[model samples]
Target: MKKVLAGLGAALLLFVVGLAVYVASRQHLKFSVPLPAVAAATDPAVVERGRYVVRNLASCPICHGDPKQMERAQAGEEVPLSGGFEFNIPPGKFYPSNITPDPETGIGRFSDGEIARAALRRGA
Candidate 1:
């Protein structure tokens, strides 16, 4: 009985070590690479189309527009997008990043591609 128990314990220890080694090795594998860049749009119509797509389909206005304005929308006020809203996170804190086009206060310095990367690609 003692010999049988000793052998079973050794086997379990060896199995756990082997599983750890396999998992550690698998973490080093490469998955994918970045794609090549596309051509820029110089046409006004293309720009307008892109803007419409972002506003309606992507729903960029939801986070970027003023929270007060969104509330007023229910009451029939035609409030233009002017972003300033706080996002609450648990464990006791919150942050509100400005999204308005105001140069001094918001993302006026970022290029269109940077914005697209953040919104579309979910890249930081």
Candidate 2:
């Protein structure tokens, strides 16, 4: 009985170690995307068009915050985009990133390309 228990314990330990090694080996996984060489749009018309696309065409407001805050934002109020919204799903809990322009707590330091990559391909 003692030997059987010892063997079972050893097997469990080996399994855990193997799993850890497998996961660690996968940390360097990479995904590639072909991003075109594009400069920031400085044109007022283009800027306004992009803003309109995000605010009206896309569901950015609904995904970013509660309805009340979205309404205020739609009413031309300055609403911070600091995201800490949590979603509990069957897979796990996920906290959406804070996308505010705040340098400390948001994506202020990230380049536009980096932000685009994250938004488009979940890469950063």
Candidate 3:
């Protein structure tokens, strides 16, 4: 029994040391290459295609709603996606930003490039 306990303790110590070493090694590592930049869309057709992609493929509507109806739609909902959702992490609340097309309440004032950057680059 004593031998078994000693063996278990040694195993635990070794595991903790291994984990510390791995974390320290990761802290010193650096990326050697930069991420490639997305190309800009020039043609009107390309811009329209990008809009379609953002609307359908990206499911932007799931978070942002029709600007005029957003207030009524979110009145009773807990996870309205207009910035009122609780996250498990940090033991606090997290809310999704309103992506509506309303200039005052949503991303309507943001330029196309800014929107694209938020979507593709910042993952916001």
**Judged by TM-score, which candidate is best?**
2
- Of models 1 and 2, which has the larger TM-score? 2
lDDT of 3 at 5: 100
Give per-residue CA lDDT, model 3, range 9-122, as digits (tens).
999999999999999989867544333455567999998997677555776545554444456645633232344333456766555577656688777887766766676665
Q: How accurate is candidate 2 locally (lDDT)?
A: 0.72
lDDT of 1 by residue, 21-96 (tens): 9999998797553433444488999988877775677766666667868877446453445556566666554434
lDDT of each: 0.66, 0.72, 0.64
Winner of 2 and 3 under TM-score: 2
By lDDT, highest first, what's the ranking?
Answer: 2, 1, 3
lDDT of 2 by residue, 1-124 (tens): 9999999999999999999999999989976876545556899999999778866777565556544476688787656666656788867887667777778988888677777777654544
In angstroms, the error of model 1 at 115 is: 2.3
Q: How many residue pairs clash in each candidate?
A: 0, 0, 0
Clash count in backbone of candidate 3: 0
